[model samples]
Target: MPAGIRLFLGYAIAILVLIGLSLRFVIDQAISMPVSPLGVVVMALLAYTIFTTTLVLQRKEAARGLAIGLASLTIPGVPLAWFTFAAGPLGIVLAGLTALLAVALLRGLTGQRTREWLSEP
Candidate 1:
């Protein structure tokens, strides 16, 4: 698929999934999140969305290292830390894992094979 189309579709899918899951959790569990917790979720989603779309646009060489570094520092790291030490919700940890997977897929799409292909014909 074209990069633009893929990116748009990825965004659409991610947003829909996030919204549906969040609503289901809230409605089914009668869960009420504090503003800070909500803010963290929103920030993570926004960061992952930007990073995924950027990777999809063939800017991987520039972004790959940075994205990896960010993921290592934030995604699993912070969520796991919170879940273990600070009593963060399991839902937050799961959301972070999803974001990490999206970024990993985006990175994989720009592998050495594609780089070699671009370097050739």
Candidate 2:
């Protein structure tokens, strides 16, 4: 597989794990209080991420754009991490690492090698 695809898959898997963890919390919150709209949105994102990851892994031509879009979506998380840095030092590290990964993913996805590799049958 192309490095770009690997990068995307790794990121997607990490997101899936995080979402799974958060879903537990969301479920607990729902049990005690009114369900938040954010929970619904997160669920939708989780489903989309899983779909995109599967297509990308299968090397579908359409998945290139889907992977790019998914990577683009993660860019906002960097600033969100930074803004929430007051919570802990981990926020700073998270923001920096997320930014680095986002940039790398964008570059790798758009690179010539990745483009050619994905274009193959």
* Tens digit per residue, CA lDDT, model 1, 18-92: 765675554444345444555566557656756655563554454444444433433455455555655557756
What are the C-alpha RMSDs, in order, of all predicted structures? 8.7, 2.4
Among all candidates shown, the one with the greatest TM-score? 2
In TM-score terms, candidate 1 sits at 0.35
**Per-residue CA lDDT of candidate 2, range 1-121, in tens?**
7788789889999889989888888888778777688788888889889998877767777788888998998799898988888588888999999899999999999988778767635
Candidate 1 ranges beyond 4 A from true positions: 1-12, 19-34, 58-60, 66-110, 115-121
